[model samples]
Target chain A: MKPKRTGKPEAAAVDRDHALHLLRAMTRIRRLEEKCAELYSAMKIRGFLHLYDGQEAVAVGVMQALTPEDAVVATYREHAHALIRGVSAGSILAEMYGKQEGCSRGRGGSMHLFDQETRFYGGNAIVGGGLPIAVGLALADKMQGRVRVTCCFFGEGAVAEGEFHESLNLAVLWQVPVLFVCENNLYAMGTALEFEHAVTDIARKAACYDLPSTAVDGMDVLAVETAAARAVAAVRAGEGPQFLECRTYRFRAHSMYDAELYRSKDEVRQWKKRGPIATFTQKMKRRGRLADADVKAIEGEVAREIEGAVAFAEACTWEPVEDATRFVYSEGRMP
Target chain B: MIDGEQALRTITYREAVREALREALQKDERVFLMGEDVGRYGGCFAVSKGLLEAFGPERIRDTPLSESGFVGAGIGAALGGMRPIVEVMTVNFSLLCADQIINNAAVYLYMSGGQFNVPLVIRLATGGGRQLAAQHSRSLEGWYAHIPGIKILSPATVEDARGMLWTALQDPDPVLIFENSGLYNMEATLGADAGPVDIHQARVRRAGRDISIITYSASLYKALEAAETLAKEGIEAEVIDLRTLRPLDERTFLESVARTHRALIVDEGWRSGGISAEIASRIMEGAFYELDAPVARLCSQEAPMPYAKHMEDAVLPQAAGIVDLVRHMVNAHG
Candidate 1:
């Protein structure tokens, strides 16, 4: 269901702790991404910094429904996903900093963060590349009789890739449990949705492959979480593949390099008014689940955390150039 | 010359490969064979003819005509802790999934900072000689060998055909085994207990002192034939079969070149930027001082493989051409 743009977040059923947890999650992503932009500007990070600015609700809500056992494959614009999936903020920043202490050991910069401990598959840079990987991960789980879901996140742009069609078909054909999440942030690089997809409705495209799909208001944290929980439960129950099209928008440019000539300031300003963090914060305050002091405390705590992460990243050491060729093949193996 | 206790059986190369797949599936529960027509259709070239009935459908899977999808799924399966043997019908079709093989399977371990290892094996029929024409016929193993993160294996003999698959599956990284379509029907004697073989070294198929005929896959047989013809004329040529193309056993061939004082590379792939070119360059870099004459290569003609038999034959490197090249190198050097 489309979220009401004017009403308070339907918070009547949400308890205090859960409401605050969701608020903190969104706040953490927002603060972390804001810092990442500053770092990119300061030249502390380089090579295509895609901040997950206006879409915090999607990652925050979806992650709330996933277990640690589930695998996640996300796009290059995945700093928020990685952070929400429990990759330490320090490691994520260090990865962008190209440090050996980074989660990907500095080998993968911004677009290739990977953490085996979290079962996070990668920060895949190619559009539509992670769909097949997620299918295969779920295929392995199904073959081995493991009850787990593999959540894959991509942009609406990936809907145009053949791998998307092939993966959905294979997922249902083989009956693997994978949740395909399309973060429809409207623009793929500089191209608009209409310019890329003939059908702007991304969820309907998943229906073509007989996949059960839902289009949730990506700006509403509760909406995304509800849809994701249902989808994840069905996938875990071996209901084959499920797809969620999160209708969202990116407040920042597509990348640090983009001028965003395809979009306008007016449109960006309108989306910002519906920004996930602000709307959710205002709704919780209105419901009396939070106060001005609570928001202030949360902001202060998140700010300190971001500072600590930045400090950790700044102190991390560079990987020795001698080890540059190390991971090309696994170490301690005959190449 | 055989030991009385050990029994040997004669089998076709196709049977040997099937035996390897059957052994791998039986040995490891995590091992499965996946590709188009690998199940009910019994493989494109019938290499996996009876596997589906033997191992059942789960282990012997048949995928749709989505090369990139299945191949990427193979990479994902490998990451998720299963040893997958993905087969593309031929090297020509592998292009559709080159992104998966080169980008995903190959770079996963490295890009992930060694957190994940893709224990995946890709098997595909390579080379031309069946008049499958340009679209179906290709010898692009050399192009794959150019990639760093994966290993390339060309099984020219029955023993290698029977043994390489299991060894490749054991590798922590991805390995692409190129089974030349031309050699699938060749028959040879192999021990009944024949199992996994080393995939790291070049094997000396024939020993001599005059020249080193370096080749692999189906071209190895042609080089051996040329060596036999040259041996009859009193010019003994050592034949080196490069079983592993990527991490090439340059030491074996370099040592052979040092003793023989001359080298001639025979490959089915085109000469320009092919494995032959890499081997020649390596020889020049490693054993140039030991050579009595400059190294030479006999590769397929720089053109698309034709459908007609005579035109195809004219394009490929034949035994006669190898013999003539060896004769000229030996005679002129002497």
Candidate 2:
């Protein structure tokens, strides 16, 4: 499939305030993830922590086009998605701490954060697991005649799973309104796209299902937002499902335990030069939209927010062992 | 066949199950049935015939042969506030979608820390009698019963076949209904107005004082036949049909064993690590003191089901095997 570049930004779309806001959102994820890595080393936040280091633009940008009424299904490395979807950083951090006050009540450590109020379906750990759920959510909306979109986010690794093909076929067949956002970050864990897939054009796979698809520069927050807004509008207007392959990279290892044995350090350094946060900041400065003082102030504010979130997580009470067996089956709604 | 002046109606097990689906769709606007060939194809076993015209494609949805995808979609639909009844053609085919059934549907409620509960019902035909071979015929209800978060129901009777769907739809968590394929052609008289049945308890099909023959699904009929043959031999046998496999009604069989002072479990599933072993263990745990003889179990032979008819019949738990086991137990205890 051809990469859609019509919505590509040639100039600043917003003034100083909006750019800084987006910058802060991406930086919040960066800071929180950095703290998470530190905490992992300190033996505090235990469990598989898949950090969303370089791919912040994808989550922040795509989520901007969604409303609270819309549903979201995300992969395990979804700290940014949960945060952008209005889940409190304290709750996300508290979940990592395994505290009951956290989102998901501490049951889902890092990979399974869920919030019913925001319609965040999960932090699904299984590769390609969320695609069907997203399609089903869209089916519910279509059957109910609700004008809403279900945006599903997964790694490019999911394209190889049978559920991906099945879900795409079902979504298009039923005319369900879903925006399938595939984060094609060039690697599936340690396997590069070239090594993993015979054809690395992930968006092209949707053509077989007759769904409209496009490839976008995932590192540019503005381009991702433009593509996502267009896709979300198409889905909301009773059009069939749309697929967006966000071409990006994860600067960190797959999880906290990776040794970075696959790719060379030079390649990592080259990608780091075009990191989403840095590239966006540079673009804003070049356009005379954001000042250096604004950048420092944004950084300071985000640092404080991360500190408060860490403190909140540290102080939150642990779930009582006696209540461990609850919620297996719903206890039914109270009358 | 008319049972009385109360207006009896006879229906096959397949029809009863279909009736249950129709009633569920008619009663609840939120409930819908989706499966491979559940629509125009009228279900693989012809159980859902005419439902496509009645409910239309919107509700009587047909799906591709993607078990995991559709099953996961059913769970997602349930979470999205829709009650979906997903039919897998058979229990053997359900293995393809077991991940979604086990991990997502069963684990979502607990994994999400009570934020979500999948109110989904999955119905699949199970058991062996025809020469459908190994993959086509499997009694995996026992395997599903091993899970913690989901409920398992084996509808052995026509009433249960007609009644279990509505109750299963009303459940707040995932529920699996295993219909024995061998019993689909079996017919029974139903009242014109039959409704939902409670899914939590076991029913005593026949009462006797000598020994308790506990079983479920298609095996219930075998146990009842064994009870009859034992009656002619001057040994009365109480028969208990366990409708709910999980959260098993240990009280019913335990009380029956207390009265008869003997217990024999007949399950169509394999003997080792199967549902019979669980019931036997429960019997030993709860009713050991009251037993006049050691609890005996007659399960399917430990092997993959062969294709031949006689071999398949021999591999399953049958009436003759039940009679032989019960006779030995009664003779030894007496």
Candidate 3:
């Protein structure tokens, strides 16, 4: 794990200890996701594996800036978000494998991972479906006076959904504590952002709702954390909601199912040059915050975590055929 | 847990629902209400009247007209550990929330593979007789009953209206309680108090041995009236009210059919592929030997209910319509 300034305008409030913690959390997510890619090719995992290969900084940076009381809502491209928020890597991977040991009991498959303890709401498969849910969670928190921020992460393409506008209005109107973090990877599946949206500046739309918003270079982990920290602070101070437009990109295709018809090889190459994990590692090596030995140790630790998850899933029992009729009605007392 | 017996009360359909909401909110800290006008508006039918003043705004929430948004939010709230009672105003309005109700909430329990249980209760006023016209008046509970992983109940009597909500709340899956607008003011006298009604069984409201009349919701009384009129003519007709539509009580239905060897399904839904058709088909499929004659059915006319009062009376099933249909069936069977 390493922390490098990367020429980002450092928020002076961020101390060395906090920076180190963010770096470790980000490394864990980056390594776990990197392993998932290999696992996908090995046929150990199947279904729609939308890897956050390049955009690890957005989830790690933003989540590290929030408190434990916060609730997280995310899209299908959210393995990084769940891991960064403390959901066990084994649970997420087993869920991807569609095993009962996984979070959501393998019911949600790759897209609906939920950890009630982590306050990680779901891996909502619908493009913009998780936004309103985030608002509802924020509403519940506000009404209960829990003083916990509800941080929601979605792709840049989610801007096209009706739920996006509806959730924004409700969150701002109610003065709820919501940090709407848009992991703007600049593409929605096979379609590029410019081709679909009339206005490319997503933060300006947040302004339309009279809400405060910010746009940040999502590749730089330290930069994202600085912006997220300020925004999270403002929202927690009862200043209503704040939107952080993370200018990032996914290195892989939208999903495993995509044939890669939309983007050019040049575009993928360009985004890869700024990949969060690689960029952060280079800076950390330069700053003496990390060593070659430390990197190996981190990778070894992550490999073991994933191995444990696979073993756990293998040992998991399938729900009995008769039990299929069990949870359908929670009121089992009925005659 | 509140004892089901003592909680039951003999009241009008409207008051019974109000008491249920109040009790649910009081009984559980996790229970809350959210809908289009559930708060300051006092509910469209005042079924949740004084709830806002009693439970305050936290428990009784008012939402914008975006049905999909609010209903979807209710599902999320349920997932977030709160029991939400979402009122859709009317079944006609539920169309707007269909995506959230049908796609999201209905399938969430199974889709999550038992990781989550949506203890959500969606209450809406359904059926016709208010002369609210085509857009406002339609019985669409049948369409919802088509979905899996959800429980559907159409409560016509006061006991059902009151008891169904509690049962729905106790159930882990999403439950939609459709209360007919026409039955709101109708009162019922249940001995000293309304008995705790089970949401899963068919109740034999009237007894006879010659012919069986199966119906539910607003059409229950009409079918019973038809049965009474037939008794005067020496035609014994049994009436069964199907309280819940989703888990259809086939045993009770088949038992009645097997005994009388005749069935007349009365429904307020449109004639094409309606619930009545389902009942007739089930009887034919399961108990073919019991039939004295092919199962008869009397359903609403296949036209969009017209606004004219006389036209409305003509299109829907009435006591006279059921009575005439039963007489024809009886004559044919005899």
Could you report the Cα RMSD, in angstroms, for every candidate shown? 2.3, 1.6, 4.6
- After superposition, candidate 1 runs with Cα above 4 Å error: A1-10, A333-335, B1-6
Best by DockQ: 1
Model 2: lDDT of residue B205 = 98
Residue-level lDDT of model 3, residues A219-292, one tens digit each, is 98888888898889998889998888888988887877788888899989988998887877777767666677
Task: Report residue A292 deviation for candidate 1 (angstroms).
Answer: 1.3
Ranking under TM-score, best-scoring first? Answer: 2, 1, 3
| lDDT value, residue B66 of candidate 1 | 93
lDDT tens digits by residue: candidate 3, B112-139? 5655667788998889867777888798
Tens digits of per-residue lDDT for model 2, A140-163: 888888898899999999999989
| Better model by DockQ: candidate 1 vs candidate 2 | 1
Using lDDT as the measure, the top candidate is 1
Candidates 2 and 3 compared by lDDT, better number: 2
| Residue lDDT tens for model 2, B157-206 | 99999998898888889999999988999999998888798999999999
The residue ranges of model 3 lying beyond 4 angstroms of the native Cα positions read A1-7, A11-31, A34-44, A67-69, A307-322, A331-335, B1-11, B26-29, B190-196, B271-274, B301-314
Given candidate 3, what's the lDDT at residue A217?
89
